[model samples]
Target chain A: MTITDELLRNNEQYAAQFSGPLPLPPSRHLAVLACMDARIDVYRALGLNEGESHVIRNAGGVVTEDGIRSLAISQRLLGTEEIILIHHTDCGMLTFTDDGFKQSIQDEVGIRPPWAAESFPDPFDDVTQSINRIMASPFIPQKGSVRGFVFDVATGKLIEVTV
Target chain B: MTITDELLRNNEQYAAQFSGPLPLPPSRHLAVLACMDARIDVYRALGLNEGESHVIRNAGGVVTEDGIRSLAISQRLLGTEEIILIHHTDCGMLTFTDDGFKQSIQDEVGIRPPWAAESFPDPFDDVTQSINRIMASPFIPQKGSVRGFVFDVATGKLIEVTV
Candidate 1:
């Protein structure tokens, strides 16, 4: 079986033990944006119960335009007030530059991607800047607690980015 | 303490029993894009072990340009071959239209968002269209298994959206 099929089997097990639907809004009134790294399970790391928070993730955990959209919706429609942003150590985005990645794709596909690859050299710097991006956005209503952190992959400890 | 502080305390416990840094690339060579809903824990739902797959989530789990960027990076740099797209029932996106959401924001903020709110009438139809978005992208190298599903919130079962 393909890996997808294997996962479907896993889903069956999940469904068997699953409970009914929960409420629509986040219980903790929190929203978290983190990198889509394989090893970082946001729920466990944050000790979040199911239905407590909205989890928004992407490549570098950078606050792109899409992230703004997600955060806006989270605060506007869903009653989420606190925002947490997580960028981990040893991210793939640290491996290359945006120009280089775009060039590689352009070379292979004969068409350059217009969007920024958002590869960053430093996770902490990116986290600080991402927070700024959020604070500067008029779309996001709640800027009261937009905290940023860098998760250490080795220890699984989240170190707050304080700059 | 603020909720963020409380979560930081939780992280200490997670780190106490936490394992070391896993590999940067997903061991299962899979990537999943799902909604940012609090109820759906992608790892437990898919029965995925940590470090097995890259989990990308956003507000709607729709294949926006940002989703394409994440998927392309997953395939090109991280070696993820299969893609699974998930939308869910009782979604906040289904409750409003793009125009209405944008208009509401415009009325409040006096500036319309340039981006589509990406609201849809049906999860099934949107899942189909999202899959088609992946199929039509030149950036994503692997279109072999771009499957889309709608997660039933109440039953905790995933129904494949085959249109």
Candidate 2:
């Protein structure tokens, strides 16, 4: 069966497994900021179960305005004290040229490039750069600790990039 | 060079190319709620650029309490009105048994399993179910739309699932 079909079936099973709120374990409440690359399975990589940590993902794993905003809120309201930024290998963000990506989007959907004035950033090489970018940002909570890592999609191994 | 190296290098180039605030595109302020599986590249998969969308990720792409809380803020404060949920294949959430995962954590880290009360809910079959759950949720903006999809990690193709 397709992944979608499989997931739908499982959800039904899960809904039935618990009649009320599935009792969640008390979460240590760590927050992770990582890339949205499909290869990095946060739960498995961190060996976490439900209600353990809050994970936020985006392209390049860079801390954008919204990312920072969310992180701020997570720290202020969600009880997340630690942050982990996980970037991965062979990210398509590195493969596509900015002009090419814009052109492809324009051609596919018949919509003009939204941010034609802005160029796309390439995020390949020294994962620490992205980590540093996030750490350097003023939006992240100054008091909270931030960690960075490179997750190898092929091997499922996580290598620490920065502390 | 390895994909990780390439991504870091590419990010530098990307940063150099777009040095200022990106002009927001019309209808570009969207929020994507997707899975944390490593195989999916949100930027390439959905043709998104740096300032286009806010991506919130978790296991099974499920909209947990934190996700809903973020969605409220993203919609109310961050100009995000749309939501997309993407789940993918060969998910570790499907293969690793909850007991195995918990036991491995105990063995490796010397910490007790946090969610000792419940088993890890298989997420492969839970994505669509999660989608439905999100749609039915009262916290999501009533006027906003939620889209669901299952991405084939092996092929890098996206198939739309029901909303």
Candidate 3:
């Protein structure tokens, strides 16, 4: 069966124990920008429950323009103030540079994508850089308390990055 | 205490019992783009284990240029073949309009964000549009089997959008 069908069947069981809606605004007034790595369970890793915080994720979890835009909307409109940026060890981003990844895509698809990979050599440094990007954005109002972390996928350990 | 500190303490306990890493590429060869809504547990709701699938999330999980870039890298660089786009009901994105949210940010921050909020009226339609956006992107190699879903925040039910 397709993965979608498999998930659909799983959701049938999930819906059987369904609970209703949570409020629009997150209860903790927080948003987390992290990698889309399958190993990092943001909720279980960080002790977050439903309705506690928004978890924004991408490939490298780099705070790109679109990520900044999401955070801006999350804070400005949705009432989430604090931002946590997390990047994980052993990420696919560490596998190649932006140019290298783009070239690989070009070779495969016969076209160069208009976007960058935003790859990083060290996920720790990337977390700090991402935090700085968020702090520097004119859109984010609450830059008072921003933090970054490099989560160890091997150990499920989170090491704070001082940015 | 700061949220970071709270989470760090939590991670300390988590790491104590943690095992080693999962493989780099997702075992299921799947990637899912979903909302960052705190109520939706992407792992639990989808019955995804570690290393099973890549879960890309943002405010509304609307596939943007960067999101497409990530997917391109995920498919071209990695081996993921299927794409699933999911948006949920009672989303914060549904709470405001693009112009309205931009104006609010402009009023508060003294500068209008260059990015759009990407707000949507109906999440089902939004999911379809996002799926189309991903399918239209030239970078994505596995656009043939793309699917979209509107997850019910209340019932934990997934209604597939036939896009």
Predicted model with the maximum lDDT:
1
lDDT per residue for candidate 3 within A1-163, as digits (tens), equals 7888998899999889877788878888999988988888888888888888999889999898889888887887778878888898889998888888778778877888777779889988888788878778888888977888888988998888976
Rank ordering of all candidates by TM-score, starting from the highest? 1, 3, 2
Question: Would you list the C-alpha lDDT of every candidate in the order shown?
Answer: 0.93, 0.52, 0.85
Winner by TM-score between candidate 3 and candidate 1: 1
Which of the two candidates, 2 or 3, achieves a greater lDDT against the reference? 3
Worst 10-residue lDDT window for candidate 3 chain B reads: B135-144
- Rank by lDDT (best first): 1, 3, 2
| Best candidate according to DockQ | 1
Q: What's the ranking of the predictions by DockQ, best on top?
A: 1, 3, 2
Tens-digit lDDT string for candidate 1 (B1-163): 8899999999999999998889999999999999999998999889897799999999899888899999999999999999999999999998888888999999999999999888889899999999989998999999888899999999889999885
Residue B43, model 3: Cα distance from true site in angstroms: 0.3
- Candidate 2's residue-wise lDDT over A65-139, tens digit each? 445544544553345666667776655355445477556545655654343211234333435565566566544
Off by over 4 Å in 2: A1-6, A18-26, A115-126, A142-144, B1-163
After best superposition, candidate 2 residue B13: deviation in angstroms? 35
Please compute the TM-score of chain B alone for each predicted structure, in the order given. Answer: 0.98, 0.75, 0.95
What's the TM-score of each model vs. the native?
Answer: 0.99, 0.49, 0.97
Q: How far out, in Å, is residue A32 in model 2?
A: 1.2
User: Residue A133 CA error for candidate 2 (Å)?
Assistant: 3.5
